[model samples]
Target: MFVLAVILSLVTAAVFAAAGLAKVQGAKQMRDAAAHLGIPWDNYRLIGVAELVAAAALVIGIWLGWLGVLAALCLTLLMIGALVLHNRAHDTVQAMAPAIGVGVLALVTLLVRIAA
Candidate 1:
């Protein structure tokens, strides 16, 4: 169970880190994508920062147990929002995969911790 939590946390961290960096470095692209999704550009930086923070929390949480659970919850919510944004942009196929993957992994990590 501990191992599963560690793996899940690491995977979630990597994904969020990449996504956050893309949002930060590729602001124009992110803005375009957000526009397509009907999201305001004003929110882009905030979202990027949130993702980066959440990713850090997840990694740090690994050593802190319950913090990991909270981080998982945060990442789960972030993924859910990502799915909604992608869907709004008519990107259902692309959106579903990562959203589902993250959701399942987070859920599994939560369950494993609970069982332990």
Candidate 2:
């Protein structure tokens, strides 16, 4: 269970780090996504920063499980917001799958963090 927690934490952190970096860099696709979600560019970039912070917390959480739990909870909430925004934009389920999938992973990581 401890090993599982570590692996999940690293994988989740990596995904968020890449995604956050793209958003912070204002990649074309991320810009388009922000527009689609009706969020201002600055606010969207702030969201990216939040993701980066959470990813860092998860990395530090390898030794301190409580931080991992906190980070996972934060990611889960962020993903929930993403799902809501996608729905409001009338996006297809395919478009929402990544958020849903990552949200599930975050939730699972949270549970593992607790158990471990």
Candidate 3:
């Protein structure tokens, strides 16, 4: 359980960090996504910051199980919001899959950390 938790946490952190950095750096894709989702650029950047913070927490949580749990939960919620926005935009299932997948990873991380 501990090993699983560590693996999941690292993978989730990597994914979120990459995504967050893209948003923070104002990548073309992220900007387009924000516009598509009707989110303001500033608000989208703040969301990116939130992701980065959560990712950092997950990394730091390697030795601190509680923080890992909290970070995973946060990521899960973020993903939920992403899903909602995507849905509101009438996005295809394929377009929403990333959020669903990452949300599952975050959820699994949370469960594993708790078990560990």
Across 1-116, the per-residue lDDT of candidate 3 in tens digits comes to: 78888898899999999999999999999999999999999999999999999999999999987898899999988888899999999999999998899888888888888888
TM-score of every candidate = 0.79, 0.97, 0.96
Cα deviation in Å at residue 90, candidate 3? 1.0
Off by over 4 Å in 1: none
**Candidate 2 TM-score to native:** 0.97
In model 3, the clashing pairs are none
Residues 1-116 of candidate 2 have per-residue lDDT tens digits of 99999999999999999999999999999999999999999999999999999999999999887899999999989999999999999999998998899989888988998899
Model 1 Cα lDDT, one tens digit per residue, 34-82: 6877867668767778878878887888777787777777777777787
Worst 10 residues of 3 by lDDT: 105-114
> Deviation in angstroms for 57 in model 3?
0.3
Candidate 1 vs candidate 3, TM-score winner: 3
Candidate lDDT values, in order: 0.75, 0.94, 0.92
Ranking by lDDT: 2, 3, 1
The lDDT leader among the candidates is 2
